[model samples]
Target chain A: MDKLIEAIARSGNPSVVGLDPTPALIPSQLMPTPGKDQNTAGTQPAHVDDGDDADRARSLADAYLRFNRAVMEGVQGIVPAVKPQIAMYEALGQEGVRAYIRSCALAQEMGFSVIGDIKRGDIGSTASAYASHLSGVPGGRGSSPWHEDAITVNPYLGSDGITPFAQAAEASDTDLFVLVRTSNPSSGEIQELKTEDGRAVYECVADLVSEWGRESIGEHGYSRLGAVVGATHPQAGRSLRARMPHTFFLIPGYGAQGGSAQDVAAMFDDHASGALVNSSRGIIGAWRTSEGYSPDMSVEEACDTVSQCARAAAISMRDTLLAALDAR
Target chain B: MDKLIEAIARSGNPSVVGLDPTPALIPSQLMPTPGKDQNTAGTQPAHVDDGDDADRARSLADAYLRFNRAVMEGVQGIVPAVKPQIAMYEALGQEGVRAYIRSCALAQEMGFSVIGDIKRGDIGSTASAYASHLSGVPGGRGSSPWHEDAITVNPYLGSDGITPFAQAAEASDTDLFVLVRTSNPSSGEIQELKTEDGRAVYECVADLVSEWGRESIGEHGYSRLGAVVGATHPQAGRSLRARMPHTFFLIPGYGAQGGSAQDVAAMFDDHASGALVNSSRGIIGAWRTSEGYSPDMSVEEACDTVSQCARAAAISMRDTLLAALDAR
Candidate 1:
């Protein structure tokens, strides 16, 4: 946790680009060609060509890997971390998951912390398995497969569900970001519901995050266990910041999700080191909507422009956040 | 949901064997030999040889695949469904995920409804991505990769997080089991907290689930949207059943987790068709701790006995559940 905080401080940025690669985001040249395999019986959906499924999955996975590698190179110095939402890779099946593993590896090799955005939660043994997977415990060939500095976790199953993850993080010297107040439009349907004690569900979650972090405080005075409080709710962010003094924050909902730099300013401490504001589509696909970029460009041409566009977007976001911090 | 209810009715059993394969549960011969991969630089833990990681993961995954297939065959006629917990596969990385895909495919092929026990939750786009993955939308070569009939989801992010999954279920004519009262020891830490409106947190989530299922009710008077109420808390399960009459239940925490047939009896409707009880470790690893089983058995001997042991366990659980229903 302190390492992440220090990185943010050294880079003069508290932002992380979310590498959520979808088929549409990949360049046209990288799209997989249809496979010729014919073994389409059983659970493979009728819509897909059964025989060539593995080949196609492998192709798409490769495309995503290339795209992610490019994006990592583009955003190298502007951001302190890269969060690969596991679901995106998961959607592509095993091949995509392998791409996710490789993507995390490349990001770390490039000197950026990797946050595996896998919102996994379960009971005892199941939860332990997930924690082990993240921390690389009982790893294959004596090494963990996916090397992530931190991983996002859901707390719906409560403490026992989270205990295994906490223990894994403690043992591995990694970190955890528990979901608290999400940035979605309908998050309040449950998170904002008032409790009998006058606290909202999110507030209760924030308190738990604070308590969970107490034992894992780092040299920077922040716990490795953090809370994911979305940037969309500025007021909630402000209150949660005050409540979870020891807990760092992973603030999503920035950029395309409608959270501006000003909206997330309260998430950080006075030094602007307590939070990492994430922008997925905003950075990765910046070339699509940037003023100087054109959608009609050839695949190779567009690919060449993505790095510059992504870097520009990261710089812009970093400056905005820094300005917000300065003003506060 | 109606399809699931019908399957349960046809089998005269509302139980599902959870295929959560672990290394210990796999026969000794299937274990992967140590790999020679040396790519372990960067964040990859120093303890593992990175060079042969993929091969090792593939070996482990193949072992798990064989084990799951055997279990599916063993429990084919006795259980109405098979729930593959995604975590165990995820631990092995991409190859493990492939095994999970094949496991679900095999179970479905064997005529058992598959419930993907992937407790995934996220906001909007991410949730939609997960849903698409579940439904095999944009699957490799245009076919869905996994063939699950239903999936378990978490509801911590509120309505927005669940909406995408519900939408996907509706579109695909499948089902969803949203977490309400999870089958964990510390579930009450948040689930049982009192809301200001005089409802517990789980009660509030139950109301939301009922509402989500309203538009998707099927012929059996049950909606495709179900609730996961742990068998560990029978009283809570009973009340949740009464509260969400149209919603079915995926009851976990049986056998190894200490929930008896009598304990989960209330989860079912009068016709004994509203729930599917899941027993993972109990059914899949029955031979490991069974009376006649010994660790000293040869690998081939253990493999031969696993199916019989699994079958006996399923038959025993089925009888116990039927007796409980009859008494009710």
Candidate 2:
């Protein structure tokens, strides 16, 4: 995570690439565009191919892995990290899961620190199990294709769910990003509830995040325990950053969710190190809707454009924050 | 979940076989013996196969899965459901996860309802993602080899995490078992917290479970929403049962955790239809330490004997509950 902070500083950007591979988003050449009549158990209705359901699933997942690998390669040196949304690959079934693992492996091999955006939470022992899955400790069981340098977590089970991740991070030098203020429209329902201390529920969560990060501080003066605060609320982000000064922040809702460079500028610390703004659709499919850009653009070209846009936004955001800090 | 309740009533028992696959418990014949050199990527460690670490892990997980499949095959006529502890399998890695999925598929194929004891929780969107992964709804993406009729959940994220599951279950006609009083020693840390209303956190959770269930009551007079009350806490189980009459109870910690049949007799609704008592090690591995059995026994024999013991215990519990009701 410190490396992530430093990387953002050196690259003059605080952007993260989100690997969210939707089936419809994949290019036709990579898909089975040649035929639709080939039949087996697992063939997609849109493009039936020669294989059983398992084989079809495997092939589809392979395409996803290849697609994500391209995106990672295209975004390298431009973004700080890649946040792999686990659900999209998982929906493909076992093969998709396998593909997800392969994609993680490829990303890591290419020198990208991966953030497993799993958003998982559970009870004590079960939470420990999830931590083991993420960190890949010696005695811990489970094969996750990628042992994330950090992961996005859910703090729903309260302290019980949180402690395991903190302990695992301390022991393994990994990092965890807890969900404090999410980007969804319905987030206000529970996250905005009033606490007895006159703070919103998310504010209470922010206070807890600050407390938990106390011992996990790293060489970079930032703690491994972090929080996921949506960029949708600029004022809220400012307030949260104030509360969790030493904690890293994973800011979603950046490009696709309507957050802009200026909107996200306040999230960063002095070195552009404290925050990593994430853009999923905005980064991965930027070329699709760009003026004069056609769907006929190769997947590689489209992903390259996505990376360029992300880099520009991230740079603009960093410059804004630096100027404000110097003025102050 | 309704079918599972009907199955329990028709079988006149409420026994749930838990598939807790600890790799250390598998028999020696399996391949990939622990401490065996699994040196991958040119990295060789001298102790890949030597310690009980590898063997115990391999054997335990394999044995657990094999034992679960056998139980599914044997108990299809008597028991209603089987719960798979995700932690046990997750310790095994990719193969272990695959085995867990295989066992769930096998159980469902055998006409037994699967209650995935994952205890997953998160914020709303993420929680909805998990529900989609577990229940296999339309837009929720992830590849899981098996989707259970019901999954055990953690509700610490408050209403936001739970509402998505409720909505999905309503749409799918599935069910959920939320953690109320967990069966672990350290569970009291958060569960016992006193709310401002003077109710223990566990009680609040129980009330929430009841509230969630009210909208999902079936024609059979049971709700699709359920609660997991550890049988180890007989008093708490009784109280929670009273608070959630229509909600089904899935009680773990019945055997290895020192909970007795009589201790949990109060958990059941009429005719043992509303509660499923789970036993993992006590039933599946009974031959290991019992007087009448030994490791020399054939796998088939051990499996049959263990299944019989489980059946007997469930029948005895049912009869005891009926007798107490008659006396009342």
Candidate 3:
């Protein structure tokens, strides 16, 4: 978190680019057509006769890495961090995960903080295992498979799950963000439930998260354990800001998810340095809706278009957030 | 779930062997000595000159797979299913995940159901992506990298996160278990909170899970959507069993986790048809205390010792569980 805060300061940006690539988001020229790359890997499962799914997945993984590399090229210096949503890569299976790690590694190489949006949580011992995403190998050392600076955690299993991650984060000089109030539509089903003591479930979670971060306050006056307060809940985010004074936030659901800059403004601190707003499709997928993009473009041309569009979108988002904070 | 229920009845065992291999859990001889396996891959990061960590991880991954293969061979006909906790493999990074996938694939090949203990939760869109563990490649076809019969999911993100998994389960003819009352010491922190309506949070979640299962009732009087009720909490487990009638249960926290057969018996249905208990260290690591084990044994002999001990421990557990059910 100290490193992240410093990176944010160095870049002069309070936003993190979300690298979430899907088949739908990729250019047609980049994907391996049915029988083309299918000859590379082992045979497909007997259930399907089309081709080797593993090989196809590998091709997609490669395409995704290329797509990510282009997008990173676009937003390299404008954004302080990149949050690679693991789910997208995970859909492709192991090959997809390889791409995800490579993407994170490339991002780090380009001098950007990497946040793995892997909402992974489990029991105590298992949580320690998942903490390897931060702490690297259990017994061995050096670079970990997943080059993530921080990762998002789900706290449903209580302290038994989170403590291991916190310990790992401390050991690795990394950080974690607990899911406090997500931006999803049905998040209120459990998070907004009022307890007997007159506090919402998310509020209790906020207090717990604040406690989780109490011992690791960085020089930036924010804790290494951050909170994920969706930009959709502006009023709740504002109140949560006041409640968890020392906790920084990674605010998602902006732009494409309908969270306006004005909606996210209240989530920031007086210096506007406490929260990092994220926009995945709004930036990375911006080329899809851009007039400059054409389906007939070559692979390099399409990637260049995506790069420029994503860069423009990222810059616009940064400026919008800055203006919103200034107005506040 | 239908497949799992049938397998359980056929084997006359409602137990799933948990494959949770760790460095501490594995035999010292299995790991590649620091410099022995370092030549296979590129040099390690310049930070520490301590050999290639990736190669080390790959070797550990292979060792874990071998260990799991031995455990599976031991419990093959005795146990109906195997639950591989992905975190242990994930701790090693991508290679570890490869081992996990291969383990699942091998288990499926051995005619056993595989439950992936990946408690992944996220927003709606992201959850849909994670559902790929059940539903293979997004647009692609054929076998998934993860050969899981079912997966465990976290319900912290509410319906938005769970619905996708349920949909994927239905499509793939697989199943999902949602965390209800976990077995950890600090589980009560959030799970036991009393909502304004006087229901504990887990009960509310139980009702939600039951509702999530309503549309997918299988022939066994259970749903593809299941509940993870720890064996450590008998009273709560009994109530939850009554609460989620349509849902199946994957009970963890047995043996090494302090869950006795008596403690878990009440969680079963009248015919002992609705639940499957899991024991990881107790069964898989039984060789540690076996009189037949010797440090001088070869890898094959060690694995053989592990196999026989695991089989014997698994048989003992089955008998103990059946006796408890009979008493109930």
* Model no. 3, DockQ: 0.57
Q: Which ten residues in a row have the lowest lDDT in candidate 2 chain A?
A: A32-41
Candidate 1 second chain TM: 0.92
Indicate the residue-level lDDT of B205 in model 2. 73
- Highest TM-score model number: 3
lDDT digits (tens) for residues B1-328 of candidate 3 = 7889999999999999999999877777787785633442344444753236687788899999999999999999999999999999999998999999999999999998999999988899999999988878866663567899899999988998999999999978999999999998889899999999999999999999998899999898999999999988989999988888888999999999899999898898888889999999999999999999988999999999989999999999999999999998
Best by lDDT: 3
Q: Give one digit per residue, the lDDT tens place, for model 2 in A241-260.
A: 77888988898987667676
Q: Please provide, for model 2 over B167-255, each residue's C-alpha lDDT reduced to its tens digit, 9 standing for 90 to 100.
A: 77776567888888877665664466555456666787788778878888988777888888888888998887777888888888786
Better of 2 and 3 by TM-score: 3
Tens-place lDDT per residue, model 3, A1-328, is 7898888888888999999999888888888785733453354444764246687789899999999999999998899999999999999999999999999989989998999999888889999999989877766764567889999999998998999999988877899999999999999999999999999999999999999899999888999899999999999999999999899999999988889999999998888888999999999999988999998999999999989998999999999988999999
| Ranked candidates, highest TM-score first | 3, 1, 2
Cα lDDT for residue B118, candidate 2 = 73
* DockQ-based class of model 3: medium
Using lDDT as the yardstick, the better of models 2 and 3 is 3
Instruction: Report the Cα lDDT for residue B295, model 1.
Output: 59
lDDT for model 3: 0.90
- Candidate 3 colliding pairs: none
TM-score to true structure, per model:
0.94, 0.80, 0.96
Rank order by DockQ, top first? Answer: 3, 1, 2
Interface RMSD of each: 4.4, 6.6, 3.9
